[model samples]
Target: MIIRPALATELPALRTLETAAGAPFHDVGMASVAEDEPPALPVLAASLRAGRLLVAYEEGGPDGGLAGYLMWEPVDGATHIEQVSVAPAYAHRRIGQALIDRAGADGGDRPLTLTTFREVPWNAPYYARLGFRPLTDAELTPGLRAIRAHEAELGLDRWPRLCMRREAAG
Candidate 1:
């Protein structure tokens, strides 16, 4: 698999992957947006314009289609992982981790931070295995205010999202 910067044309695929990833949280209304179109297009376009989106690909058996993607933004003193998803058929292949590792490598001069639900598997403990530590909301800096606003607009108010951080290797 290869991880690289996402192109504007890949927005649809990235949105598809994101919607699939949100399935696990569907009962909580996580993927509540209309399926008629991928919302990531506008966000991805804006982020790419700002130079912050990344996509991952692997040669599908005989087909050359995109495999997965991750979107993030660099704010304040950290890189915030906006979303990471692989096609439903491509789950369990470590594509998510590969994209995350790539992000860590590219996050220059800042720590990598992300917010995930407090539930099992998607929470701080899971990321701890990858070297992230949970941080209190009080610890958030002014740089992350915009991110917090976006998350709020998404209606992710249920479980307290644990803010995890890891120093970037790059």
Candidate 2:
């Protein structure tokens, strides 16, 4: 799949992709997650406008539509992965990894950070395989702390979560 900036008109399609991406959670006993609302369209629009959003599409696959997406924020000089989603149909294709790699390149030599469910197979462990390491509580930067707080406020604290970091390659 090719990763590129998202077009403004494709925001709704992204919401659909988000829904499909979250469906696997139900199979893993996280039904609430499957039912959870994707980021609001306004939020997606803002991210897109800020050049923080990227979508993946197959070059000559089934269709020309998007297969996945990733969104990040420049937080404290690092690219903080706010969200990443790949359609279940396209799972295991390394689309998500490609998005992460793109974000790392865009971030230059700055670190990359993200908060995710600790037990999810494709969450913390997957990132660990890609060079990320779990951050100790003291290692949590202020921006990451704030992100955790917001996630808690949204009831995501019901599951074990951790902040992970992939150090910049010098």
Candidate 3:
């Protein structure tokens, strides 16, 4: 498998993956708790435009095929993982963890932080196993604040998020 930055041409596939990954959670209205909105294209576009999208794929596969992806940004000397998704068919295959591991490895000396839906089993504890611990709002820095603002503007629920952090490995 190979992990690398996303290319513009891969946006459609990413959107498809995002929609599929989000549907089950959305059906229960627990995925985001945000007001009804278009599926995932807008957010994906914004993340891509920011140059913060990374994709994972099996080497030698078709050019646009992806196993999973991580969307994040540099925040207060840490990498803030905004979202991670694997194609539904690809779940339980460690693609998500691989993306997280790649992010940590790429962070140099910085730490890694993320906010995930608290009730999602795959959100908090999954990261906890990797040494991330829950964090309080006071611990959030300016970059996190910006992220929070974006979420807020989108009407996303803030309390359901379990903010987490871990020091990067050297």
Comparing candidate 1 with candidate 3, which one achieves the higher TM-score? Answer: 1
- Of the candidates numbered 1 and 2, which has the greater TM-score value? 2
Candidate 3 off by > 4 Å: 27-51, 59-65
Candidate 1 wrongly placed segments (more than 4 Å): 27-38, 61-65
Model 3 steric clash pairs:
none
Q: What would the per-residue lDDT of candidate 1 be over residues 57-124, giving only the tens digit for each residue?
A: 78663225577777788767688887766776667777777888888778776788887776646556
The lDDT of each candidate is 0.71, 0.90, 0.77
Show how many residue pairs clash in every candidate, following the order shown.
Answer: 0, 0, 0
Candidate 3, run of 10 with poorest lDDT: 30-39
For candidate 3, what is the TM-score? 0.80
Per-candidate TM equals 0.82, 0.96, 0.80
Candidates sorted by TM-score, best first: 2, 1, 3
How much is 42 displaced in model 2, in angstroms?
A: 1.1
- Candidate order (lDDT): 2, 3, 1
True-structure RMSD, every candidate: 2.9, 1.1, 3.3
lDDT string for model 2 (1-170, tens) is 67899998899999988988898899898899889999999999999999999999987665355789999998877999999999877889999999999988877999999999999999999999999999999998889999999999988889999999998866
By lDDT, the best candidate is 2
Candidate 3 accuracy as lDDT: 0.77
